[model samples]
Every structure is written in structure tokens, then in C-alpha cells.
Target: MSHLVIDIGNSRTKIAIFDDHKLVKNDVLEDLTEEKLRDYLKENSIQQSIISSVRDGIERLENVLIEQTVYIRFSAALNTNINNQYKSPETLGLDRLAGVIGAKALYPGENCLVIDLGTCITYDAIDNDNVYKGGSISPGLNMRLRAMHELTGRLPLIPLDDFDGSEGNNTGTSMLSGVVNGTFLEMAGFIEQYRAQYSELRVILCGGDANFFDTRLKNSIFAHTLKTEPDLVLIGLNEVINQQ
Candidate 1:
């Protein structure tokens, strides 16, 4: 059966069509409309649909999906065989939960650490036994740059494209070094700590900034174990459908 998964994140909306375990089509959009969704449904014979949205205001789209297909309302409460040990499951981000679920689905019988680099950086871990004990969250690259710029008087908002990973030669370069390089170091440090605990840890990177970190980490010590899946949330949502 074909599955349609939608992940509505803080900055972008990702939609994917899966033919069972294989991803057939994927798209990233600034906004998902009823017309656009209808177009997709018309083009594909989607049987099951799942959606994970970090924001609100998608009721119309949800209604259309509900009426047209077997819609799965993804939530922290969904039973996907994950031993969720989070203190507050209701407060957990569905994206984060789906991320670890995706990790487990992709790398079964192994310890997985999922680092999503988007509006925020989230580090979630799932053990070989599918036990999710929760993880950490921090400011993302853009958030760090914007914080420095908005919080201070002289620090300019340096674009992420300007990051060169070099020692600061000027004010802009310095900010770039601080945000980009700092974030890289922070990620490396998190991976190192997680590796220490889970000796057989597999790191999965996703989200808008996944490519940036994947490029930087390819030469680092974590390269062998690191895998980037920009469509991880979509994959995870599809996994949910499979389980159902």
C-alpha cells in the first residue's frame, strides 16, 4: 500500500509518498494548502496518511486528508512499540518522538542518536531495545546568530552561507566562527558524550541544516557512524503507518 506522510516543521513543510518501505516522492514547501494536498491525492493512490505538525492552523488540510484517506493523527500518545520513558510524554514534540522512531526503524537492534538541526537542535537517543529515555535541545545555528545580533548592538546578523570555519579575521567572520564553528563543536561534543555511553551508537542527522553538519562531520571522528536522512521525520511517520 502507498503511504503519504507530512511533517510540518517550524520553517518548512515536508511531504513524502512511500510505496511501502521505499520513498517514491518527496517535497519541501513553505506552506501546504488544501489545493496542493488535493493535487497530490489526485496524482497518487495514497491509502494511509500520517501527519506530524509542530504548529497549528492545519485543520482544513487535516479535514481533507481525513475525508479522502485513512488519516492517522500522530501524537505522543500513539503506540508505536517504543518504550517511551519521557517524564512528560504529552509535552514532548511529536517530531522528536518520530525522529527516534525513525532511527529505530532504520537501524533496528542498535543504539541510535538522532540529532535534528532545524529551528532548534534536538539530540534524542533510542537504545538497542527501543527505549527512548529522552535527550537534549539547544539553539540552532540561525537562532544563535539571530540571538547574538538581536541581543547585542554591534554584532551583525551573519548569514549561514558566509560561514567558512576559519578563525575570525573580521567582525562578520568572527560571528560566523562563533556560531557555525561553535555549533559544530557543540554537536561533536554531544556525539562524543553519547558515544561514551552507547559504545555502538549510530548518529542520524536530519532537518534543514543536516547537510551543513554532515559535510563538517564527514572528516571528523564520528564520520563512520554518522548518517544523514533529511527526510527522517517523513520516514518515521511512514513507519507509523506501517505499524498500524
Candidate 2:
């Protein structure tokens, strides 16, 4: 049976179909509602499914999904492999929870660093013992760029392009360099910090900015090549649902 997994993020919602542990179709949608979700599910032969949301609006969508299949929502708890060291667990973004779950599910019995570079940059670590240690969060690429433009009067809002090795020449290019390079350095710095604490660290990068960082920082200190899996959170949500 094919499983429909939906991941509701801050900016968009991602839907995917996983057939017997293999992802078949995946797409991101801006309008996440009962009608749109129903249409997507009807297009596929899904009998069971899961939904995980970081930005809310799941009640209506869940009602629709339940009419056709067994719909489950991913939630946080102490039972999950990761520990909730944060002051308040409920406040932790569901996307981050899904990323950590996905990392643990994808790379079991290993020390993996899951970095999600989306609206916000999140670094979650799962140690060799299958213990989920918390990670850190920082402003993302666009956030930095927007901050430069909004917080200052002279700085122009610059758009970032695909990463093509680190040197920039013009004003826009200079902003791009600072945002991208600063992000890369931040990631590298964190990875290095983790390495000092954890002997063997396996890194996995995901999200919109993952490619940019992966392409530019692969050789420097990132031990592995860039592995971009857009539907990681969805898959992780499915895993959480299956368990329940």
C-alpha cells in the first residue's frame, strides 16, 4: 500500500507518496487545504497516510484525509529518540522534530548531523547510541539578506543565486557572498564544534539552502558530498505515524 505523507512547513506544505518504503512522487504546495489535499490524494492510490505540520492548519486537511484513508499526525514526546532539552518542548517547530526523526530513521546506528537550511537554519544531531541530542538554530539566507535590507537604509535587498564557488565582485554579489559565505562558515563552525565533542559525525544537509551550502562547502570540512532529499520531513512524518 502506498502511504501519503504531508509536511506542513513555515512557507509551504510538501506532499509525497511512499510505496513500500520508497518515495514515488513528491511536490510542494503553497495552498494546503482540504480541497487541494483531497485532489492530490485522489490522484494517487493511497490507503494509509501521515501528516506533520509546523505551521498549523491540519484540522481541515485531516478531516478530508480521514474520509479516504487512515491519517495520522506526527507529534513530539519524550518517547521519541530525541531529548527535549529546550525549556519548552511544545514550542519546538514540528519541522525540526521531523528532521531529527528523519535523520534517525535514514541513518540508524550512526552519528549523523541533520542540517535543515530553510526559513531558519537548524542543526540536529543523533549520536551513535541512537540518542537524539538537541541542535541549534540561526537565521537563514533570505532572512539574512532581508535583515540587511530592512535593518539598514543603504543596503539593497539582494537575491541569492546558485552557489558557484565563493568569491563575489559587485554590490549584490558582495551581499550574496556575505550571506552565503557567512552561512557556510556558521555551518562549518558548528560541524567543527560538534566534531570536537563527538568523534565521528555524519552530516546530512536538507532544505532550500542545502544545495548552496553543499556545493560550496563540500571539500572544506564537510566530510560527505551534498545529499539533497526534499521530502525528508515527509518521510520522517510517515515514520512517526507508522509507529503510532
Candidate 3:
């Protein structure tokens, strides 16, 4: 039997199946329909399913999961083994909380700094005391590019990939440098600031942009390495099921 974990985000949907505590399958879906989900569940020997969604329109999928398998609604109330000290628990994103729990589960007794780079880059860190102190959120790389285009009168939305540490020659390259390279610097600064306070901090970088940054950040080879887990949220969703 397998446990199905679904993370519905603003742009993409992540589906992961865990046979016991081990992940057996992982998928990223851009176009998700009820029939598609039903067909998937029917094919798998799913024991239970849990969903952590950021946006609406998941109610229909929720019904499909309920009819197909044992459905568990992931909420902040779930036993994550970490004390929640955030001022506003209700407004906290389920994905963010889950990321921290995922970090805590993987690196126990150590202070973990979770930097999730997705639609939004979230900085969530749980201290050695297992207390979930709130962190910061900023516009992700794509979001920065989109914002520039939307806000400016002439700047076009450009694909960001290359950066050579220099201010780009043209408008397009300039945008990439500012968005991608700027974000890189911002992440390094955030890690340094946190490490200054928590000397033994274990950094966990996850989400869609993790690999891009992971490869780029390793070039510096700082005193401590940044740990990248592209499927941290999926692993954490499975952890939520295990907690029960």
C-alpha cells in the first residue's frame, strides 16, 4: 500500500507516492483534471491521500480523493513535532510549515534554515529547540521578472538563466543579471545573516529553483554547504502521514 501526497501550488501540482516512508514515485503536473486524478488513484494501491494546497479549486479534487481513497486534510493542526511560535498560524502557508517539519524530520536536534525557492522564495528556520520562529518571504526569480515587466512601461518579461557576475550588456541580459544574480546575492546574504546567529545551522534549500541555486552556490564553497531537496514538500507531506 502507498500513501499519496499532493501539493497544489499556484503554478504547478506535485504528486508523490510513498510506500511506507520511502518515496516510490514523484510527478509534476501542470494540467490537472478530476478524471486524471481519478485515473491515477485507480492505478495505484494507495492506502491514504493527503493534500496541501496553496490556492483554491482543489475542492473538486478533494472529493475525488475521498471517493477513491482514505483522505487526510493537511492543516496547521497536524502533529509536526515542532512547536509553532509564529504570530499568525492561520495565515501561514501550509507548504512553508511543512517545509520546516520536513527539515526537522531530516535533521533532528540541529538548527535548520529552510530556504524554499518556488513561486515565492520563503525563508523558514526552526531553531535547535524545535521552535518554529517565523521567517521572511520575497518574490521569487520568475516573480521578479514578471513584476519588472508588469510594473515598467517597456521592460519585457525575459527568461532568466545565465549570470557572469557582471552587469549585462543589453536590456535582456541586464534583466537576467538583476533578477537571477540579484537573487543569488540575496540568498547568500540571508544564509550569512542566519549563520551569524545560529553558528551550527543546517541550511536546506528546496522547491523548483533549488537545483539552479544549488549548482550556482556550490561555486563559492562557503564554510557550510547548502543542502538542496527539490522534493522537500512531498517528503514533508509523507512525514505528516507518518506522524499520525
Q: lDDT, candidate 1, residue 228?
A: 95
Between candidates 2 and 3, name the one with more favorable TM-score.
3
Per-residue error at 43 for model 1, in Å?
A: 1.9
Q: Model 3, range 1-244, lDDT digits (tens) per residue?
A: 6899998887899998999789899889996789989889878888899999899778999999898788888888766787998888888899998898888878889998899999999999899888997999999989999999999999988876564556889988899888888888998898889889887888899888877678677776553656788788888888888888
Q: After TM-score superposition, what is the CA distance of residue 41 in candidate 1 from its true location, in Å?
A: 1.4
Tens digit of per-residue lDDT, candidate 2, span 115-168? 898989999877877666477989999999999999998888876764355577
Candidate 1: minimum summed lDDT over ten consecutive residues — where? Answer: 157-166
Please write out the lDDT profile of model 1 over residues 57-121, one tens digit for every residue. 88999999999999999988888979999999988999999999899889999999999999999
- Which has the higher lDDT value, candidate number 2 or candidate number 3? 3
Shift of residue 93 alpha carbon in model 1, Å: 0.7
The count of residue-pair clashes in candidate 1 stands at: 0
**Clashes by residue pair, model 1:** none
- Candidate numbers sorted by lDDT from highest down: 1, 3, 2
Q: Considering summed lDDT, which 10 consecutive residues are worst modelled in model 3?
A: 217-226
RMSD of each: 1.0, 2.1, 1.6
